[model samples]
Target: MKKMLYFFLLILVALGLAAGVGMWKVHRLADSPLLIRDETIFTLKPGTGRLALGEQLYNEKIINRPRVFQWLLKIEPGLSHFKAGTYRLTPDMSVRAMMTLLASGKEAQFPLRLVEGMRVSDWLEQLRAAPYIKHTLKDDSYRTLASALGLTGPEQVEGWFYPDTWLYTANTTDVALMKRAHQRMVKAVDAVWKDRMDNLPYKDQQQLVTMASIIEKETAVAGERDLVSSVFINRLRIGMRLQTDPTVIYGMGEHYRGNITRKDLETPTPYNTYVIDGLPPGAIAIPSPASLDAAAHPAKSNWLYFVADGKGGHTFSTNLNDHNKAVRSYIQVLKDKDAQ
Candidate 1:
């Protein structure tokens, strides 16, 4: 009887120890702090199984241990949940909380900013530089990609994309971004072109975009957009050459050395407004929405000439004499600044 009692006591003690270990594991999984001290993006890629994921989380220090999680994933009825996404995880969260968050599927996002008046090449460089975005353009050829975008104006891809802050996931590709920006531009143009001023000289919406791009490159001041648009409009209405420097520079292409040479203006390129009678063959740069709106509805003004004022704005003139005087004054201002 003594030996039996001793054996019974041993069994009871062993059972109690096992139960205690189980409770400790449950408590740790339920309330313990995560190994990561702050919020981080934990990407669970596609085809990541539960056991493999647990091991990865453990290796990444996202969790203190993976045994409890692995066991729960195997045994818990109606709790088998996992997803593939870039998850924003925090250290204050428990294992159960993390599991809940993963199940929720509210993935993290990234941002791409396309600024107005930027060159397409510069924009592509930015897309290539972003590490998070997937690169789909293996050829790195803008012309081929532009053709794929189904662009209409100029039969080229220079000023086709809308400028805005676009947010997306890590899976977003360069081609996808290009498609979205181009679509946005198309939508904006279609919406604004419907209510355009009557009897406009532009042949179609593409010509309007071309004009807007010129206006965008002309002025950095938002308030001056309409006035600048009017100057271009008046010039076009009277059969005068644009002679805008930006277009000449764009025509120079790789040869442009920060300034337009006399030969560059004299040599003919389709983009050279001086050489071309009307709007350039296509947009010189990407235009903003305000500029596009200004192109559709230019302010009522007969003023055809403008010269840069001493300030960061332009002085508009209707007559040749006044424009020459303004140009002289601008040159003098520059000389005075240089003499100083």
Candidate 2:
């Protein structure tokens, strides 16, 4: 009986040693390099099962053996804590590290770069097509975003959201992202407002913004902004009509299919600077910081007229006669070149 009891104890000890060795092997496998070097992007859709995920990883060469990975999970039990989402896994990361990464559920962020001078409609189209962002703007997303941003009276949120690159998680809400963009614009406007030229003809910062929007639309060349601002400022100072073509186009409303016609300029509307004799009521489009600066600190010049020289730039003139002469010269030059 003593010998039998001693034999039973020895078997129990041997089994315990075997279990310990098995667990150690599993731990080493979990932390091995095989799980680290796979360069595949794993998108774990909602309701993906752990067993399926393990098998997929094995098939993708992320793991050498699916059975071993599954056995490790059963042994640890904590490996099932891994959550679902998009994960970019490196080829060389250990299985343990990958498990930890997924379990934490942290995702990589993609940047959304909203450039200055983009209209709201333009941005909306871009957002709809963005790969990292998931949104369906079929309903009141725009209106909801505008209202959340405290923008008033505009059916569309154009010219309101400030342009800047923003980083967001993959699952970020559209409204939240838009609100952040709008807040950035508001902060930018506030920061620049106090530094604006004092005692300008405009009543408030809003008017300055309105004028800046016009300047933004006029030209994209960096050096020409101040010159263009001077033309508009001179017109404002002398009480002459702005006579800007863009304002006319804006006034022509949604039916403006293409190009401004002579009749369109003559057709009076509130936004038609040729007839309105002052700044327009609101911004036509969002302006860049350079345009805002140009509007704030206009060049000290008597230039009141400008015309496109057809060389991707404009020629400036100080008076109507000079402007007409420049216009004729530009036209004649183009014609002469064309004739050659």
Q: Of the candidates shown, which would achieve the greatest lDDT relative to the real structure?
A: 1
Model 2, 124-210: lDDT tens digits are 767776666766345445475566556675643656677777887776766678878777767777777778776567887677778
Worst lDDT window (10 residues) for model 1? 71-80
Off by over 4 Å in 1: 1-21, 37-39, 72-79, 91-94, 152-156, 336-340
In order of listing, the candidates' clash counts read: 0, 6
lDDT of model 2 at residue 183? 76
| Alpha-carbon lDDT of model 2 | 0.79
Error of 2 at 141 (Å): 8.5
Error of 1 at 205 (Å): 0.7
lDDT of 2 at 129: 67
Clash list (residue pairs), candidate 2: 36-91, 36-92, 36-93, 37-91, 37-92, 38-91
